[model samples]
Target: MKKFTLSFLLIIVGFINAQAQDFQGMAVYESKTSTSDLKSRFEGNKDITPEMRKMIEDRMKGMFEKTFILNFDKITSTYKEEEKLDAPGQQQSQFGGGVKMMASMMGGGGTFYKNIKDKNYVVDKEFMGKEFLVKDSLPKLNWKMESETRQIGGYNCFKATAVRPVSKSDLRNIKFKNDKKDAAKTESKEKTTSIMEELEMPENITITAWYTPEIPVSQGPENYWGLPGLILEANDGKTTILCSKIVLNPKDKAVIKAPTNGKVISQKEYDETVVKKMEEIRKMNSGRNGNGMPMRMP
Candidate 1:
């Protein structure tokens, strides 16, 4: 009887350990983007005044600085922005609206869900007042791990790097090219120069990520994943996302599920739809203003 009781106790302990190992984790990340380069694009252009430039920079700063939460388990994860209330008396300005429109074109706001075991993902995106459930295969990032290590949030992290293709419409890649000759032809050269005539977008960008093996999970903030361990920090040339806090197996666990509210579509289909919408908007806004000058699409 003693031997049987001891065996039963051992099995119970083993089961408890297994259950503990299958726990979920939540990570909070603070994301910010550098606006220096973006501001430089308008430098020396007669169109944008110092005051207007300051306002544009301020709007970009607010748009890019955000907090996000990543909830993950062994094989699946969900990443989304943490909602925050605006200050009293705060209203959306014209610049804010323009930035929001650009964000919509780039599929900026979304709840991204990734399943490593199935090698797929689903994202909830809102564009032009319509929502889309974008389902697609996970992008395979070829990471090159380096020997460099650092500490982040009490976890030792190793560095890894990868290169990824950039979207043509990505706001980060927007660059303004001013033409002096074109501005000279207009009566209001300052206004004409201020109107962005050419925008350049890069084709690719390099990503640097730091992962902590202590967590022992393949997860990261945003669309980044496939690391051998949990990513604590990641940065591209323009933006950086760093883990601020982490909670393991909290009392209230987040439900990691794919969003099903929007119209189902593949990633390609969603991109095509956005592009078509943009073309329509451009066409509608084309032609001269009442003053017989070319109208700029806001």
Candidate 2:
């Protein structure tokens, strides 16, 4: 066979470069969560007045609304929250200890670094002023492709669904009160307390995601990935993350680097640390405050 001409080879090389450029970009995502359950939980406390409840609700709403940036290049990506303070109400809520834990549980309080090539990830988390670098493999999602499709921000997206097991404590609502029938049938305090214990088995939750193959990077905001394309919208029962804008091959390229400085530990170890710290706080504060007023551990 005759050798290929230089002009033909150049054209093929240019096409390959164009494809590589398509995968290099930065995406901005807006994450929104419904604070109705949180509001209800706060309102249940008799000490809080209606006006105080409303103010807390408003503050929770601000915390729930967040913006994230996903910077990617081929097989590696770094996703982090774009830190911003809009109002004094939100600023005050942001610094609260419980709010930080809640945000971490909701997948909004850390920087996630993932490499699709190696199927590994690192999460940088701060708990009560202590920083932790949690290293673990990526979460494996069993996704089922659906025939449904939609357009988000001008990108044609296909629907995919998956089921994830979530622990009861992970949920914003932890049912403490018993129904009327149960309360009437069992008058023993021990029996009622046992019934209210945290569940051992995880609750199965359905997740729906919309992704577009137009952008071939298998990345999404906050520990969600393993799709055919860039995920445009994802809802995991509790919170929703939607991509608002995408800039491909920007004038200033995004730096896709992982967080390096923190106390290194595995995912399980970090969880244990949090639980141990909480237990210590509870022990320190026991029988100290009265009047049924709310008290937070320092």
Which candidate number would show the highest TM-score if scored against the true structure? 1
Model 1 stretches astray by more than 4 angstroms: 1-21, 41-54, 105-107, 177-197, 283-298
Q: Model 2: per-residue lDDT, tens digit, 67-129? A: 899998878899988986666555465336565565665555467999988988898887667
lDDT of each: 0.77, 0.73
TM-score of each: 0.81, 0.79
* Worst-scoring 10-residue span by lDDT in model 1: 289-298
Clashes of 1: 1
Error of 2 at 113 (Å): 1.1
For model 1, residues 128-231, the per-residue Cα lDDT tens digits are 66777989998789999999999998999999999988754456655555556754564354332323335555678899999999998998987789898999
